[model samples]
Target: MGQSSSARHRRNLTRPSQISSSMMDGSSKGTDLVQEDGVIEGHDYISSIPDDVLSSIFNNLSTSDRKISAVVCKRWLIVEGQGRNRLVLNARQELLPIIPTIFTRFDSVTKLVLRCDRRSVSIDDESLIQISLRCQNLSRLKLRGCRELTDVGLAAFSKNTKYLKKFSTGSCLFGVKGMNAVLENCKYLEELSIKRHHGVLEPVSPDFIASDSLKTICFREIYNGHCFGPLIIGAKNLKRLKILRCMGDWDRIFQTMSTRKDNPIMEIVLERIQLTDAGLESISRYTNLETLHLVKTPECTDMGLISVAENCKKLRKLHIDGWRMNRIGNHDGLVNIANHCSNLQELVLISVNPSSESLEELATKCKTLERLALCGIETMGDIEISCIAEKCVELKKICIKGCPITDKGVEAFAWGCPNLVKIKVKKCRDVSGKVIDKLKARRMNLVVSMDSIQIEPESVVDDGGDGGDGGESEPTASSSSSNGGSGSGSVFNTRFGLLAFTFRRWSIGGGGRSV
Candidate 1:
């Protein structure tokens, strides 16, 4: 009965005339006061609230939500007039017609975020020019999936927004030519992200350098079939740089950037690029680096990995694929990293064979490690895993996919690591169903996946070759007494028991078999 009345109240509130002068007064509380002819009668709703409170609420909403709320009524539209430091208009082509109206109302917007759906809306030159003219104070602009914005629109923004500090354009079709004006004009710009864009014309001019204020820049998927030396030279003050799928003259780029004295480069990310020892040596000159990610670099070698470990002393986060590369350090790069980079907290080593001693060394030295991924590692056995479980107390998430570990590893991990919350052991052959049962019994959240239903061949055979001397195996009378009712072999019973136990344990939240 109460729910029905509440629904009716909500329906009445949706009506245009439900808000009236009486409702504005403090007396009426039960019903929504309204006039007879469906007209809202109240002035205090807008005039009474403080401007600061209204602006705070407006800033909290997303770009689209703000646009919808702005057009509800004259009073709400007037609320847009309040000075807001940041304004985000994302994916509302319907709101495009109302941009001028919003601009006329709100003249004090500083940061503007424009996100459009590539399939639906096309942000043409006129729209962008209008925005540049109206929001003159816009210092930071973020455009995502805006395909229609060309060089003309970008030029307007560059020339108009003199104080622009940060700009991010993602999934756009424009290239370096469109951004030439901005890079040349926006002297105060600090951060820039140009991701997944194509058709790069040559940079403006070698003489036209990037703003010294530029600190963090990302050039992702900038496949223009040319070197990025000119672009890198422009951003002299760049501290953090991400170069993805732009593998051209990295050696020269790094060597040039290392020449900077005052504003040295710090963080570097090279994902899916072809980097070799020469490239790594060029990168090694940037000794001030803090975070480095080398993902899917097929040509990477142990010499390169060792160069990074030896040079970059302040390295904090390191992520590298271990499968493609053969050697790491003198033996493997893992030992070099453990010796040099003592401050590493987040480590992701893929398909690398880290020895038991090196694993123990990492667990002891990198005490601040919070997230670790040792996927596709065939050499690390139960002993190495146990060392991590015992020493890395702060570890929250550990992924051990494609490792050869059994119940001993799982038991050791569960017993030692108290704060572990998530574990993924996909394609592990030795982990049995009994381990899953033990995990459930301990009320632990564990995700363990097996690749095949067949029992592992290693579990059946004993250490010695003493199963049988003659052609037929011996079935002793004493063994029958211990075998219960079913006289099948102990190996068969263990396998069947594991299968049955796992079926029951599968009902728990995070355990399954993957074929």
Candidate 2:
């Protein structure tokens, strides 16, 4: 009886190849024991895992890897479909033909990024509509470089996404119809970022009702300003507005805002926008503003800035940038702002050199100032930095660029500002790497960086031949010139390398060239 039972057990145990086929046919249970290559193994453990637990494991994988993982088994395919919440299909234009199928696979996706290459075929209305119909849970969508996307496609997509909160698209051919579609349908839309859209030339009627839920709006490299007027008027809850490299009369938008007594805007950013003192005066009506960014607006002067400071008492962050040092001026604006906005925590100045008196007053009055960024400020040196360190007790971050500052200035910051956590020094040739190293050594936890400067000079030199044959061997003139040529070549290569490295770093680290 024992021998007969053993024979039956051997007959029941199947090979690995037969196990997969039998499992698909529902002939084998997941808990069944199996024999693989004549070796007995325990019951399948992976499929026994709960869906939620397996989903968590798949969440950590890349989108491409997840697609590949789906083919492993039916269970993995199910997990890939049910678990994915974020989908980023970057440069996958080849999949444009079957976008609906792709969307069907990832039905649970909430945040979607469909970024295509400039040279590839663009996604059309049908594809977008398919996505909108399927991915109802999508909250954030970023469409980049889809040049063929028209107002029809945009409207079709926007009409379906009722829950979308944030939407950003660049290099599209959409116009007012598309904008109106989104504003009319997505009542809860909080943020909209439109960049390099060529078709936004026509005006949006002021009577058009837009969702008041918009809090942030960003326009970058757009040619027309007609659409902005309606958006500014409709976005009653707007807090942050960033306009960069956009050509148009932006003063009208501010003028419109000035008429609204209940404007809830707290943060305003005007980068490379053409506006004069009148525009600034119009913006001064918002007394509740907490953050303001004015970068590369040559038409704005000290008078315009002073108006903003006098009115916006609750201001905490301020960034003023200019194209040229001469275009910006040092005046009582800084002092007055410091006096009024005592709670100011961050200040950024570019191309505008603040006077010692003004900086001293700012350091004294704005005791809560924590982050300071000075770029291309020719007058900023040891005195200004020292004053900032001494008075701004809460200071934690300092970024100095293109300023002729030396070790003395930075050393003062290290000694005076005990709370200093990050110091980024770039294009300040006078500050050596040795001083940075010393400062880092002094404050072990402090983050210090001297851009493009080699810490140890000896590391780049060749002393192998010079050490042994020093006394008797006198160097000839030709050899010296050859060495000089080599040195010059090395210097050129080093500078080129450093410049390339700096540019690459800026492209990645710096958000944009606007400020």
Global lDDT scores for all candidate models: 0.66, 0.73
Model 1 C-alpha lDDT per residue in residues 287-382, reported as the tens digit of each score: 788777776677777788888889888887777764435455224577788888888767777656677877887888777776677766667689
Reference-based lDDT, residue 298, model 2:
90
Clashing residue pairs, backbone N/CA/C < 3 A, model 1: 328-333, 329-332, 329-333
Instruction: State in Å the error of residue 403, model 1.
Output: 2.7
lDDT of 1: 0.66
Error at 497, model 2, angstroms: 21
Candidate 2 Cα RMSD after full superposition onto the native fold (Å):
12.3
Model 1 residue 149 lDDT score: 77
Mark the regions of model 2 whose C-alpha exceeds 4 Å error after superposition.
1-41, 62-69, 90-97, 325-329, 453-515
- The candidate that wins on lDDT is 2
